[model samples]
Target: MHILLVGAGLSGAVIARKLAEAGHRATVIDGRDHIAGNCHTERDPETGVMVHRYGPHIFHTDDEEVWDYVQGFMRFMPYKNRVKTTSQGAVYSLPVNLHTINQFYGRTMRPDEARAFIEEQADTSIEEPQTFEEQALRFVGPDLYEAFFKGYTEKQWGCSPTELPASILKRLPLRFNYDDNYFSHRFQGMPEHGYTEMVSRILDHPGIEVHLQTWFDPAAAGEYDHVFYSGALDGYFGYALGRLGYRTLDFKRFTYDGDYQGCAVMNYGDRQVPYTRITEHKHFSPWETHEKSTCYEEYSRACTPEDEPFYPIRLVDEKALLADYIARAEETEGVTFVGRLGTYRYLDMDRTIREALDTVAAYLSDTAQGRAPRAFYQPPMG
Candidate 1:
């Protein structure tokens, strides 16, 4: 079988490798000049630091199989995402942990004491929270919400908390203990070489042919037996329905002679600050050291047609438009949507790889049974 992969990112690379191993010829194409998509990394010629070109991508996953799969391609160095935020003229730990609570209030309280004290501050009157603001007020009270989440959320999403859904805040951890690690996953690390090199190795199979800076026309789908698209879902249809909402980031790069914030990521929680967060790239690869450091001041805004989409904004209006696009995708044939952009959802790297592997397995199984594979492995909507 000849398979056409639309994007050369993690999803397309994983799927292409798996299919190539099964003795199928795979051709991978990407509009961008790079192969790794948003996770592309390169060395800073001046600083000799491994820079995450898109942003800081920390690989964290509890799935043992996924962790081992990545290790087969490149060595992973142990890394933990300890994050901090600047708010109200003071720096504090993230996720509103016990230490953050004590520091923000200027009081030393044990876990139990802090828990009880926060309960008193919470607005119990709202039994069920519907919006982001209501969820924060119900969980951590008004002061913490204003200090940590309000301004940051507003800037990141370009909307007031009252307009966003409560589910947005549900995934965040509000720890009673002092552990400040952002993610709770068991396996967390960085690829020793870089994401581009890791993905380059993944696509090294003899059966796979990669063409960079290639624009795949939908009319060319008939050239291959099957098409696996990792590009934008709406883009596959030429946005005939409507463009889905997304939040794209603008990274302003700056170089510092010494360590800037003494951490990997420093988020500014005050809305007065134009940018949302500043990331020190050298800190991402702590095993390697250099006298000079490179950083990015990240700014988020509504995505336009010319900008590269980052975070999907699945608000009510966008959901309605997405439903129309999904219907159009189902009506179309011979092409299967895969990855975050294809499904129009925000997904971590581990989940993207897992889904790609599962998608290929299902595709192969269906072909063996003489049945057409599904348009989607799983519904995009949860």
Candidate 2:
């Protein structure tokens, strides 16, 4: 079988490798020059520090299979993401932990006391919270929300919290304990050689041919037995219906003599701050020693056609447009949609890999059973 894998990100690389290993000829194409997509990383020529080109992507996953799978490609150094935030004039730990709660209120309350205090501050009247604002108010109350989330949410999403979904804030944990680890996953680490090299290893099979800096022509899909698309769903259809909303990021990079922020990620909770967070690339790989550091001040805004789409803003209008695209995709033959852009969802690295693995398994299984594979392994509509 000749398989066409579009977008050389994790989704494409993983599926391509799987197909190639199964004795299928796989051709992988990416619009970008690199292989890792948003997770692309490179060593700075000046500082010799491994810099995450898009942003810091800490590989944290609870799935043992996915963790062990990535380890097969590259050595992963154990890394914990301890994020810091600046609000008003003071600095504090993220996820609104016990220490943050105590410091913000100017009291050394224990876990139980702090929990009770937050409950008292919370608006119990709101039974079922609908939006991000209501969810925060119900969970952490106004004072904590204003200090930690309000300004930061506005800057990050470019909209009022009231307009955003409650699921967004639900993902963020508010702990009464002092544990500041951002993710509560069993496996948390980063590739020692950076993501680009790791992905290169995944696509190293002889049956796989990689075409970088190449645009995939949809008309050429007939040449292959199957097409796995990880590109934007609307883009596959030439945006006939309308462009789905997305939030893109811009990085203002600068090199520092020594430690710049002293942390991997620092969030600016005050709306006065233009950029949402500043990432010191050196800090991401703490095991590596470097005299100088490279950092990026990240700014998030509405994605333009020219800009790279980062986060999909699944507003009501966008969802409607996405449904139309999904319908069209279902009717289209010989192509299966995969990954974040294809599904129009904000997915973590683990979810992306897990889906890709499952997609390939399904494809192989269907072929063995002499049945046609579906357009999507995981449907976009939940």
Candidate 3:
């Protein structure tokens, strides 16, 4: 079977490798010049720092299968994401941990004391929270909400926290202890060689052919037995329904001498700050030593046709439009949608790989039983 795998990100690379290993010819194409998509990483020519072109991506997954699978491609160095944030002329730890609570209040409170204090500060009047603002008020109370989340969420999403869903804040933890690690996953690390090289190795299979800087032409779909699309769901159908809402990032890159900020990610939680966060690229790979460092001041805004879409804003209006696109995808033949952009969701690296593997298994099973593959492994509506 000749398979067309669009978008050479993790989704495309994993699926292409699986199909190629099963003796099927897989042609992988990406609009970008690189293979890793948003996870693309390259070394700075001057600074010698491994730069994450599209912000920082720390690989953290609790799934043992997904963790072991990535290890097959590249050596992953032990990395923990300890994020710092600045608010009102002060720097504190992120995720609203005990240390942050103690530092912000200038009091040495233990875990139990901090928990009780936060609960007391919380608004007991609101029984069930619907919006992000209400969720924050209910969980961490007004002070912490304004100091840590309010401004940052506004800048990141380009909207008031009151307008956003409570589910968004629900994912963020309000730690009782002093543990400042951003993620609670067992496996957390970054590729030693960089994400692009890791993905390049994934695509380096005998039966797989890679075509970078190539755009998918709908007319070309007929030439292949099946098409695995990881591109935008609306883009596949030429945005016939309407463009889905997305929040894109704009990066202001700069080079520095020695260390800058002394941390990997420094977030600005104040609305006065124009950019949301600053990432020091060299800090991402602590194993490698370098005198110079490269960093990016990231700003989030509404996505346009010319900009690269980063985060999907699946509000009520966008959901209705997405339903129309999903209907069209179901009616279409020889194409299966996969990955974040395809399904219109914010997915981590592990979730993307796990779904890709599942997609391959389903495809093989369907072909063996003489049945057509489903349009999606996970439904878009969910």
Candidate 4:
């Protein structure tokens, strides 16, 4: 069967490659001049540092199969995300670990002692937290929440913490140990050559034809046997209902002669700072020594049609709008919505690749059984 993939990002590349290996032809198209979507990376002409065109993306996942699958493409260097936050004119380790807790309170409490101390500070009265602010206060107390999460969260999402759902805060880790690794995933690393190189390798298949600067019109879906669209859900429908909310990022690029922040990511937890974090690209590839460094001061705001959408803002109103889009997608035939944007959710790289692989697998199975492919592997909302 001849399949059309709408985006040349991780999802499109992974799906196209898998479909091609399964003896099906896939034509991949992207609106951008380059492939790899937001994960696109290139060497700075002056600094000679690998720059993440969008933002820093560290590959970390517990899925062994997904990890092995990526290894088949490019080599991954050992990299752990030890994120630090600048709050109230001081630098502290992220995830509010034992080190941060001790330093913040001026008490070198042990693991158990720190755990007890945080518990004492927690608002035990709030049996069930509803908002991001409530979750933080209940778990880490007001002081840590205000100093670390409050300002940053407000700046990142462009809203008050109280307006955000509690589930967003649940993803964050509050540890009593000194382990400062940003993610608790078993495997954490970055592509040695960069994500763009890795994704390009994934799309290199005899059965696949890639077309850059090409936009696939939804009306042209009839030309192919099936369409695996990784573009925005509302976009496919021409935004007949409404545009789903998204928080887009603007990167302010700068060059530093020496080591910038001594870390890959240094988040500013003060709302007054404006930008969310500063990412030093050279630190992303620690093995490669470069005298110069390239950094991005990332600013997040409400996404407009002109901006590149990064984070999906699935607040109450957006969720309602998303439901309308999802319904429309379900009614549409011969097209499957896949990936973060298509599904209207914020997905990690590992989840995106894994879902793409599974989507193709399900398509093959459905075809074998003479069944229609599903519009979505899972619901957009939980």
Candidate 2 structure, TM-score to reference: 0.99
Check candidate 2 and list the clashing pairs: none
lDDT of each: 0.95, 0.94, 0.94, 0.93
The RMSD of every model to the true structure, in order and in angstroms, is 0.7, 0.7, 0.7, 0.8
Give the Å error, residue 382, model 2.
Answer: 2.6
- How far residue 109's Cα lies from its native spot in candidate 2, in Å, is 0.9
Q: Write the per-residue lDDT of candidate 3 for residues 3-66, one digit (tens) a residue.
A: 9999999999999999999999999999988899999999889898999999999999999999
lDDT (Cα, tens digit) per residue for candidate 2, span 1-382: 9999999999999999999999999999999988999999998999999999988899999999999999999999999999999899999998889999989999999989998999999999989999999999999999989988999889889999999999899999999999999999999999999999999999999999999999988999999999999999999999999899999999999999999988999999999999999999999998999999999999999999999999999989998988999899999989999999989988899999999999999999998899887789998876
Residue 182 displacement (Å), model 4: 0.7
Lowest summed lDDT window (length 10), candidate 2: 373-382
Pairs that clash in candidate 4: none
Q: Could you tell me which residue pairs clash in candidate 1?
A: none
RMSD of 1: 0.7
Writing each residue's lDDT as its tens digit, candidate 4 over 53-142 gives 999989999999999999999989999999999999899999889999999999989999999999999999989999999999999999
- What's model 3's lDDT at 98? 91
> How does residue 373 of candidate 2 score in lDDT?
78
Backbone collisions counted per model: 0, 0, 0, 0
